[model samples]
Every structure is written in structure tokens, then in C-alpha cells.
Target: MSATEHATCLAIAAARAAADKKAEHLAAIDVSERLGLTDVFLLASGANDRHVHAIVDAVDEAMHRAGAKRRTREGFADAHWVLVDYGDVVVHVLQNEDREFYSLERLWKDCPAIELPADLAHGGSRDGDSLGGRETTAS
Candidate 1:
């Protein structure tokens, strides 16, 4: 009833890739107990269509590098929101407005959140480059 270790690792890798693309408000929720198809949901927001696509591409590439194959992808043409299903981990790269409107975190509020590394969460990686282009301050 929990995310497997491989799934967790893949989700974290996807999260970092999203961060590298300047995706905002990144979150990974363990949906193992609620969903039979996937164990984790990795959510991220982009400022616009281009940003959303970029984040999705980054996440896909990172996951593949980690040996996870994408099962399917949705909403790529519009780029309003993109869902990359990686079997164990499902990644959502969404536009800022869409992210606010959907409020996935609220929908899956009961799910346990996966803890990302401080450096990655803070947008500071080992390369010393800020992961995201713009930082959103907590209100």
C-alpha cells in the first residue's frame, strides 16, 4: 500500500528534471493505496505552453535515463497540461493557470507526499545553478 522503492526513485528523478526546467510548485504524492495503475503522481506547474512542454520533455528524458519507460502521454499538442504515464510514476506538467484550476494537491490531499531533497526543492542543485528561472514566494 505504499510506493515501491523504484517508483519513488523515478518520481524523484522526474521531480528534479521538472525543477531544472523551472517548473513551479513541484509535488509528488504516493497514490499507491488509492490507485491501482500508478504508485506515485508527480505534479509540476509551468508558466505557459512552452514551459509546460519543456518541463514534460525534461521529466520524460530524466525518467527514461533512469530506466523507466513512458507508457503514454496526453495533452501534448495543446500544452495546457501534459500527463506522462511511466507505469509506476505518472507525471503531470501543467500550465500555471491549469494547475491552480485543477488543484490536484487538494484533490489528493490524503495521499502522503514524497520528500524531495532540500537543494532540489529550493531550486539549488549540485551544479550551483538555480533550477527554476523564476521563484514563487509563498503567500
Candidate 2:
């Protein structure tokens, strides 16, 4: 599969994993055109530290089950913003405060947003908005 296709699959798999753990504010940013090392950035926010860890765990498990290897993982102990790097895709499982503070969406605003599966897009509500409040329609 192409990079875009692979990124989409990874995004959906990550989203499903996050949803299974009842994670909030799950969104994936397609950074293939913007970044060279990775094709996508999977961003998800959790209610608290525990939830953040759980979300990251779910993402790791899903990616592992897909035969993907992690290049590195960081911020697990703090649980504020756990990052899981999978070569072409980097997953960020963060708490609301940390997510807002970092504001990665704004940093990568220039890149076109990706369209995720309907269920993943509207799965949970966070901070009165739906996962960055960016809507994606499957074409």
C-alpha cells in the first residue's frame, strides 16, 4: 500500500484502539506532505494521566498487532503527553492540558487535514468540541 493508504490504515487502527479504551478527543493529522520522516500524526487526548497512559497502551497494542515497530516512546511516566513513534506514523496520546499547551494542530495547520472514519471522528467529546473540531468526510 502507498504511504497515504498505510497512514490511513494506521490512523483508523489507532483510533479504534483509543476508542476501545474510551479515550477522548481522538484525531489524526495527515502530515505526509509536510513531514518527510512520518506520513501521519495520530493525536488523541485523555481525561487524565491514567487515561492518557491507557490510550497510549491501546495505540501501542494496535500498532504492534499490525506488525509495526516502535522507533521510540516517551513521556509515559508523566502521562501528560505520551508519544509513540512508528516510523511512518507518530501517535500522541496526551492529556487535555498538555495537548492544549502544545497545540500541535496549530503547528501543523499548514498541512491538509485527513479524513478519518466516521466513528473515529465522532466517537467522543472533549472540551466541548470534537477532537480539534475538525471534520473529515470520506470521499
Candidate 3:
């Protein structure tokens, strides 16, 4: 299975919002086959706490604009690793150090990449970005 069309669109919207907030790193993985909870995981990194907050806010707003009702938003108090969960797509806005330490991509290395917009790709590339066997395209 792959990420659904709606989930991919939501992920792209969230990714662009993260980019607007200057998220240092951005990636979206299709975890549909690997997990049952959500179809996509949109990962982003911010330089620090403030950056994380801004990214989270922007992502939340974008998701809402895209008509994604957030199920829950965690880790906002500390801003170390904020997770915005929409039923189909989960957005992770994290601090640079925390993002590196967790390295979620490595854990889900087998998942496919959800092709994102060119404008949203930023930061240095990681081995995990293309670790997936395929790249899923979306509208």
C-alpha cells in the first residue's frame, strides 16, 4: 500500500508551511504499509525552540487551511519535538539536535518517499530521504 491522495496533499501543504517558517530539513515518508495509524509522516527541523514553534504554528495553520482537522498536537510546551497529528498525516516539527538524535527516517527506512514540491525541499540531504525503494507522487 501507499499513502493516499488526501494524505499526500496534506503532507505537501504542511511541508510548504514548514519551509515558509525556515525549517532546516524537510521530508515526507509514506508509512502506509508500515503503520496503520497514519499514511504519511511529514518531518521537519528547526534551528531552535522558537523556530520549532513557528514551524508548528505554520504547519497547523496550513493543515487547517487544507481542511485537515488535527487530532492532537504534542510536545508544544518544550518545543523540542512537536508532533501535529491529523488522522491521515502526522507532522513532526523538531529542534535540529533532537531531529538528528532521533533520526526517525532510519527507523522507517523501508517506507517510500512522498514526492514533495521543489520549493519545499531545503537543508542538506540525508541518506534517509531516498532510502525508500520508491517515490510516490501526489497532486
Candidate 4:
């Protein structure tokens, strides 16, 4: 089965949160078929530990605001590869080097990617503004 609407919504919010913090290489993978543990995996990378933590905090706040409880959180101390598991959706905020090393996108290449909101589809705004709480250019 594919991811439910709730899971997709959570993933979108998490992605937006990451983008707001200037995260890069944002992507959402539908892992429902491969892993029953969670429906979606939201991956993003930061320039450094500080940026990673900012992205993680933003994602955590956004998810919690949407009423999703964080099931598990890992790698926060190092801020190298923080994983925030929110039952239906898991957000991975990693440093650039760690992201390259792990290469989750390659490992999950078989799974279909979830299309994010037009503005958040890329890691930044089309007009070169920050994402998340920013408006997008109308179609």
C-alpha cells in the first residue's frame, strides 16, 4: 500500500520546515511498500552541525504542531545525522558529509518520490527566498 494522506501531509510539513532553515537536497521517499515501520522518509542536508540542528528543530516543531508525536530521535548530540521519527513520517536532517556517506536516496531509489508543494519541491524558493513560511510564485 502507498502512504496515507496523513503521512504525506506530515512529510510535507517536515520538508517545509527543513527548507525554512536553509536545508539542501530535500527529498521525500515513499517507503511504505519496502518498510512497514513508516510510510514516508523526508531527507535533507545542512551545511554544518548548527544548520542541521536548526533544520531538526524546525521539523520537530512543525510535526508536533500538526499533532504528530515524535516516536524516536537520534544523533541530535552530534548534530551530524539527526533522525526524527514521527510514527507515520521520519525526517532526516543530516550534515552534508554524512548525507553523502549515507546516500539514502540511492538506497531507496526503487521507491517512488512524493511530490512536495511546488515551492518546496526544490531546496529553496524559486524567487531565491527562504521556504516554509514564505509565499510561492503563482502558477
* Model 4 residue-pair collision total: 0
Give lDDT for model 4: 0.81
Q: Per-residue alpha-carbon lDDT of model 4 for 66-119, expressed as tens digits? A: 999999999999998999899999888878778767777777878888887767
TM-scores vs. true structure, each candidate: 0.86, 0.86, 0.89, 0.86
Q: lDDT per residue, candidate 2, 101-123, as tens digits?
A: 88787787767767776666534
Residue 15, model 4, lDDT: 86
Q: What are the lDDT scores of the predictions, listed in order?
A: 0.80, 0.78, 0.82, 0.81
Alpha-carbon RMSD, each predicted model: 6.5, 2.7, 3.3, 5.7
Q: List the residue pairs that clash in candidate 4.
A: none
Instruction: Give the Å shift of residue 111 in candidate 2.
Output: 0.9
Encode model 1's per-residue lDDT on 55-89: one tens digit a residue: 89899889889999989999999999899999999
Model 3 RMSD vs true structure: 3.3
**Could you arrange the candidates by lDDT from highest to lowest?**
3, 4, 1, 2
- Candidate 3 lDDT, tens digit per residue, 1-139? 8899999889999888988988866878999998999999998888889889999999999988999999998999999999989999999887877877887877877787778877666765456453222223334
lDDT of 1: 0.80
lDDT of 2: 0.78
